[model samples]
Target: MPVKVRGGLYNPYDGHIDPYSVTQALAAGARHYGAVLRPHTEVTGLRLREDGRWTVTLGHGAQLTARRLVNAAGGN
Candidate 1:
């Protein structure tokens, strides 16, 4: 069988990222701003409150509210 090609795209500014290093730097920056890093915490649910705050439900039935949320769930 034969195929026909239409067009292609290219960019000279393309780059790759080291996710681990980037995450470490970001975590350090966030910690400098009083952000608490909880390791091994499982989030069960999340909801947006009427006051524009986020409600995060944990696996242990504990709920936390914050104005901003960052989902940095990594892969295995």
Candidate 2:
């Protein structure tokens, strides 16, 4: 047996992926784990209460309390 080629590259960890689909799947998984998804909502401010909880202020002066917060602010 003989092989002939000008140039080539092989990698076992190389592949193509659709970013939008991946993002959607991740969001779905988060939702399954009881994650609230609020799109187009802007976080105005954050305050720590005396009880060690976080008071997150959103746009239009709306506020919500949470034990933990995740800032996944994507690019513009």
Candidate 3:
């Protein structure tokens, strides 16, 4: 089970669990089930190439081209 916390609402149902810790645990659990972990990376743009591939540009000029792309940015 996991707890959801936002802006320190202080929900009473969740047992003594920190929101940040729970978030970290959930992310780890996701990665454990075959997920790619990329930290401190930003996607600037994505474009479909002529060969039916995706080219992604990051903030640090890091570019990666792949046949598929999954954008999972947390809401601001």
After TM-score superposition, the amount by which residue 18's alpha carbon in candidate 1 deviates from its true location, in angstroms, is 5.7
Q: Candidate 3: where is the Cα deviation over 4 Å?
A: 1-35
- Report clash pairs, candidate 2: none
Task: Provide the lDDT at 37 for model 1.
Answer: 82
lDDT score for residue 61 of model 3: 91
Question: Candidate 2's residue-wise lDDT over 1-76, tens digit each?
Answer: 2355543345578676676887899899989988898888999999999998999999889999987787878644
TM-score of 1: 0.66
Candidate 3: residue 67 Cα off by (Å): 1.2
Model 3 agreement with the true structure over 1-76: per-residue lDDT tens digits: 2455444545688668777887798789978976566776898989999999989898989898877665657846
Error of 3 at 4 (Å): 16
> What lDDT would candidate 2 get against the real structure?
0.82
| 1-76 per-residue lDDT for model 1 (tens digits) | 2345443335567666666787799899999998878878999999999999999999999999988888867553
In candidate 1, what residue range of length 10 has the lowest lDDT sum?
Answer: 1-10
Distance from true position, residue 22, model 3, in Å?
11
